[model samples]
Target chain A: MSGLAPVPDAEHESVPIGSNDDVVRARQLVRALAQQCKLSLVDQTKLVTAASELARNTLVYGGGGVMRVGLVHRDGRVGVTAVFEDSGPGIPDVDQALTDGWTSGGGLGLGLSGARRLVDDFTLQTEVGGGTQVAITKWAR
Target chain B: MLKIGDVLLVSIQVELEDQVVLELQDDLAARIVDSGASGVVIDITAVEIVDSFVGRMLATTAAISRMLDAQTVVVGMRPAVAITLVELGLSLGGVRTALTLEKGLEILARRDDSRPAQL
Candidate 1:
């Protein structure tokens, strides 16, 4: 909670993630937000890449979902966070899914873990037959 | 896309859908076969992002081109794209990379020049 931005005040935007185009748009939206927040180039790339992976997972694994992006300020540092949510079949094992080279799809198996490594903060919540939500953040440095 | 000397130059300037990425792979491979091109220079400077999917496609295309006796050189990778790619664990293996398109062409020319001319 220390790193969480003041709730109910930060500017937030949501993008629908249903298709490839949606995923692209999600990345673009996140990139613009990170840029607006004055994140360094590398920091922006990390956040955008994480957004891309999560957005793709939302589409391919969850059968489509929604992405929420917001500018955040924590510990006197500016940052951005993106939340990916889906109501599809949830992950049976969140730990396993976060492992590198673990993939339920035909991808390179780097989406989840790699994304985790690129960002400053990460959180995931899921339940079998319930849903999945992943939130990631990167603080500008 | 532009063909110059024995090298094919492709500038990716748009946010490509997955299908389009696949199509580009096919088209580049086919063109390499048909034109007998010795090299391919891909410029991604205008690209805003390099997701894992695009990374895989690029590496796959380079592998295919090598099989077709064509070398592949990717050029103009922005710093951000490079960082993202590394963070994503995509090293773009088997693909030669250059800092700029001009350097990429020079690399291909040097390799092509060193080869014994097939009369």
Candidate 2:
């Protein structure tokens, strides 16, 4: 796997997907962004699914948050990277947060687990006092 | 803070927006699998047309649900939607479909009852 330029556009498309309503907005951007990257139907679906999961996390668990979406390239295929950051009560345990069927909100057992599974590349940075940031990527390959 | 269940159910209404469909597919799929209700019925009654992204999400969700040992059936597919999905060659591949949510559920029940014997 190759690395991407920090970002694609000069200014990333950032939005507050705080409400359950905002998840759709986030996904529309994902479809558009994925299309622009020339992603195939299967790859596009993967990316968009990952985006939807992350956006849902922002709204349901984080209690409202922001997602920064941008384009990038790596491994000879175009890619889109969306970074979700929230200032809400941060995760107390990162390892547990990454596990499947582990939801503080009594969720559907997908949450972070499904999102992490969908993306080609997934990374998370979080702490007790320091909020959380999740970056996920999907490529044409 | 919002609830995942509320959000998942509300996604049924937000079907009007293509983007919303993409963003909530997993959450919705997760809820359906966990519910043990046989399968999921994606009510596309509100959508006038089927876009590539939406079609792709449906296919993806179905595939994911299959891995979770559940089925994903698309419901309320209008004639126009079906024609367009076909013309676009948007086959959900392994996913199943029916004219309405009720029909989809019936399909699931049949599949479940005949499982080991059919195989």
Candidate 3:
């Protein structure tokens, strides 16, 4: 229920999720980081929702996960990066999971792809026997 | 900590993040519709910041309020929320904004007065 101890310039924050409320709080911190980057409200909201969905997926399907929030600087530009990692059973088909309305779990199925659409950068890495990780970054653009 | 009336005009105090915001807003729209009150004023004061998701939720609530045929006004929106919305180039759609619930009510009442006396 705690996040990676956030420092003004930690570059990364890790949060452990054991409950539903924990997911929400962790994601909120990520959003705060996004806001600190001075992203537009649209971008800020997009990042928060994406992080929230990923965190929720980790909790709902994976029994909990660790959310990594960080600040990224690239080419004189600053951005917020969020990485959600879950060690639970991984997705068999990452492509299928990204498709909208393709949920076998009866959700809106907008969790992955929808999240991807909200930010400037989206990357997903998963392993069948390992776990699931979704990384997203939103810049000032 | 957002409220509409004396009894929590809005109870989706779920951190004002983007996820679950639409769901929370949907629930709020349904509750306001069901309350049968002529007007519903939402106070997002506690939500010191409004990101895109929160903005969309507010706009969605406004559209739903119109659909439910109820008067809706957003009151006590924080400066941060307003700033974010402006930066995002977002809108609350047709939702009205007020500095306080009483002011929102005053606006709603004024709108009601000019109505065709139908609703």
Candidate 4:
């Protein structure tokens, strides 16, 4: 971490998450942005992996949505941020959704919790029948 | 897909889509039988991510290979991918893994060498 820059730039890109192919596209977008931020190999892998998990969740569980990737400079370090949004039937329990081994789909139930562990910061908000939003950030160290 | 010394080698270099993973499972299964390979080494060095579906496919492939008399060794898993797998609660149980392709082949060769000779 270095001294904070007076002005930080946040480069952003958004992609739809309608199908399985879109999930891979989101991963590619985030991977490029993470590289632009100059994050280390491990950091890049973590962010991209997290993005993959979340993107899949958005498509399969949320019935499709959009993923936004951004490169952010804050706290004296550059980082990557991803936000996933879906307008399908939202989760009824945020806590349960974040818990490991809790999956409504036929999966290993590691999507949400695993993504959280891979990133530096995570936030989730959902309402029944409304939609779901998840934000994750990974800062270069 | 490549075969060397009765071992099937697959190096996955791209971000695996869900369908691609499934196709891999089918192809590997068929190749294992067609080639009469006793060992299978899937090199994932270039693979940056392994979601639950892909993880399950690997494990399933390993299990199926064993039934067909081939030992499956998944090699070159990145550190981040390993961490994410654990966090995702997928143990990839029953799947053997190695740090490198050379090591993966060595494990298979050892198994071959240790087997009893037919009378």
Q: Judged by DockQ, which candidate is best? A: 1
Which docking category, incorrect, acceptable, medium or high, applies to candidate 4? medium
Q: What's the ranking of the predictions by DockQ, best on top? A: 1, 4, 3, 2
Model 1, residue B64: C-alpha shift (Å): 0.9
Clashes of 1: 0
* lDDT by residue for model 4 (A40-110), tens: 88788778888999999999999999887787777688888888889989999888988888889888788
Model 3 residue pairs with clashes: A4-A14, B4-B9
What stretches of model 3 exceed 4 Å from their correct place?
A1-10, B1-8, B11-119
Residue B6 error for model 3, in Å? 14
lDDT for each candidate structure = 0.87, 0.67, 0.70, 0.86
**Candidate 1, Cα interface RMSD:** 1.2
After superposition, the stretches of candidate 2 with alpha carbons farther than 4 Å from their true spots are A1-8, B1-119
Query: What are the TM values for chain B, all candidates?
Result: 0.96, 0.74, 0.76, 0.96
Question: How well does model 1 score by local distance difference test?
Answer: 0.87
lDDT score at residue A102, model 3, on the 0-100 scale:
70
Expressed as tens digits, the lDDT of each residue in B33-116 for candidate 4 is 999999999999998878777888899999999999999999999887887677657778799999999999999999999989
Which 10 successive residues of model 3 chain B have the least lDDT summed? B1-10
lDDT of 3 by residue, A78-141 (tens): 8888878788888899899888657767465666776776667777777776777777788887
lDDT of 3 by residue, B27-85 (tens): 76667655655566777666645544466567777777778777778888765556545
Identify the candidate with maximal lDDT.
1
DockQ of each: 0.75, 0.08, 0.13, 0.60
Sorted by lDDT (best first), the order is 1, 4, 3, 2
Q: Which is better, 1 or 2, measured by TM-score?
A: 1
